[model samples]
Target chain A: MKIVKYEDIVLKVKLACLQMTTDLPQDVQNKLEMMAMQEDGQLAKQMLDIIIENANIARQENRPMCQDTGMVVCFVKMGQNIQIEGGLLADAINEGVSLGYEEGYLRKSVVNNPIDRINTLDNTPAIIHYDIVEDDVLIIEVAAKGFGSENMSQLKMFPPAAGIAGMKEFVKQVVIDAGPNPCPPIIVGIGLGGDFEKAALLAKKAAIRNLDEVNPNEKLLALEKELEVEINNLGIGPQGFGGKTTTLKVNIEMFATHIAGLPVAVNINCHAARHIKVVL
Target chain B: MATIKLETPLTIDKIKDLHSGDQVLLSGIIYTGRDAAHKRFIEVLEKNEDLPFDVQGQVIYYVGPTPTKPNQAFGSGGPTTSYRMDAYTPPLINKGLIGMIGKGKRNDEVKAALKGHAVYFAAVGGAAALMGKCVIKAEVIAYEDLQAEAVRRLEVKDLPLIVVNDIKGNDLYVEGPQSYLKEHK
Candidate 1:
């Protein structure tokens, strides 16, 4: 059995939090650069330039790229043969988030309660999803998801009759309704053919998926590409100032669903796209 | 379009001259507030109490900045989504708040409130690190308990912005995209 120390997990989570918030991942950076070069509007091009420059400044100075450091979301693949020493895995991850937010000078965006609306101060109680696997290695993927885009996400349950055409229209309409709020040029993550909550979670996963990575499912891959084109054609552009580049990419994740219902979730992510992965 | 340099305490004439899609370099003092602070602002107004600061001819930046690091006036600071504050905005606008710096489209009421008196500017939303550098100074003026949501008086220099909604009721969010689509077609 592989043993992972609790403190070690904490340290790694902390570092992941700090690094992800400061550095724009290479794939996202590359995509933004490509979009900037191809963008038709002068203002859109300028906005992309500023966003690229902001990424650079944040990295060079080891500071957060955006003021909203975001609520921490962690996806963990736990090995069946692995044992965590010292504390619960969730606790360790939360500890790491608290430390990282405090040490990195990131914003404490979490409120203790939705109704009470008091700041949590340490950015704790990270949203964690766990999957048990057969290997001896533990993998943790951390994403600092900003709310500007999170608030723009939408989920809809359609009758089976709606089919692919209806799904495409709904996704397109979500982007149109979102307009500049999600901070275009944006990445769209789509979850299809799942139950309500699962679809939403899948959409969240899709949003943080590596930009350069292609979808393995052939049909979904084609759908992603087609949606990317359709959304970009909408003229939402960079910062919604209008241009040729509204969306940088569209990623779709699909799963089997019930015979009666077709559920779709669209999670929009801003250009910042902060996430990191660590294997232990 | 040539970039216009605007100073704070904006005049009606200056606001009227501005148009949607104009790039602007705004300097001078502006107050920062977001959801929580705006809520409090409305509550204070409802109680007939004075605001933490005067609203007349002033600009409020909708932002919740990260914690400031050592030797820095502010941390990465960018505009939050402006629509969340829409409910509280027209009231503030009526109270002589002449300008707002934020991201995204404001509601029709905000657009109407802006006519003849105010303007709405969109800062590049996620460009917080770049935006924070423009803030030369920052001081929490009220609602310190709100932490990042606290109202801060900030002295900024050449803070880059685009006029999204102008006093003449022009909305760049609508016009900018429409123009781009036309050109591409």
Candidate 2:
């Protein structure tokens, strides 16, 4: 069995968080560039230009891409053959998040309690999801999910009779109702089937997938293309100013559901698309 | 297609002349507040007490900027979603708040209130780094414990904003898209 120091994990996690938030990913950059070329309305094109310019400034100056530095979400896929040599895994991750937000000059946006709403100040206790893989390598993905788009995420437990077409309309309506609120041109992540919780998780995973990545499964890939075209046709455009390219990407993940269940959840991320992954 | 330069302590007369879709370069001091700070401002009003800062004819920008680095006036500051503050907006407009700067759409109540009274401006939401460049100074004037959500006074120069809602009830959120759809189709 291989052993990794807890401190190293913390350091790596911090860098991933900072780099992902500070620097817009290449996949997102290229997608935006293409969208800028295709944009019809001059106003929409100008807004896209400003977003591109902002990404450049954030990368050059090492500043955060947006004011809502967002909540830290760390997805860990742990290996069975490895042992961590220090404190609790979640604790180390939280420590890294706190330091990363601090060192990056990112905003501390997390509150201590839902109702009381006190600023935690350190941006600690990140929302972490874990998976146990059958290997000796540990993979971690740290993402700063700003709430502007997160607030627009929706989950619905539909009856099996709702079918695939129903699911598409539901997801599209969420984006349409969201309008300018989620900061379009947004990325749409749809988790088509599963139990309630799994559907939500799959949608989030879909949202975190790189904009340029292709869904491995062929059927889902087809569905992804169909949904992507449908969403952009809504004419909700960038910043909801109206034009082509309402969404940069639409990714879908799926799982088997019970006979009577067809749960669907949509997770929306704005053009910023801040995420970074590392393996050890 | 018109370009306008506006100063603070805005009177209804000044904002009334503006219409939806006009571009404006705004300068002077604007207050910053989000959901929590807006709620607190309402609370102060309910208690019949003065707020930490004045609101009359002042513009409140919905932003919670990142922390500033050394020798910087501010960090990456951009407008947040506006509708979150919808419930708290009319009260401020009633208190002579002349302008609200944010991204995204406003609710019916807020739009109704803007008629002949106030205006809403749109700043590019995700363009934080570029927006921060326009802010010449920033200081937290109230609710320090709220951290980024605290009310701040920001002095800006040539801050680019588009008139989203004007005094005559012209709404870009609705009209801008309608025109675009027509032109493209």
Candidate 1 accuracy as TM-score: 0.99
- Among these predictions, the greatest lDDT belongs to 1
**Tens digits of per-residue lDDT for model 2 on A72-105?**
8878999898799988889889999989888988
Interface RMSD, one decimal, each candidate: 0.5, 0.9
For TM-score, the strongest prediction is: 1
TM-score of chain A of each: 0.99, 0.98
**TM-score of each candidate structure, all chains considered together:** 0.99, 0.98
A49-78: candidate 1 lDDT, tens digit per residue: 999999999999987999999999989999
| Chain B alone vs. reference chain B, TM-score for every model | 0.99, 0.97
For each prediction in turn, the share of the native Cα contacts (below 8 Å between chains A and B) that it retains comes to 0.93, 0.84
Off-target runs (Cα >4 Å) in candidate 1 are: none
Q: Candidate 2 — which residues are off by over 4 angstroms?
A: none
Model 1 lDDT at residue A151? 96
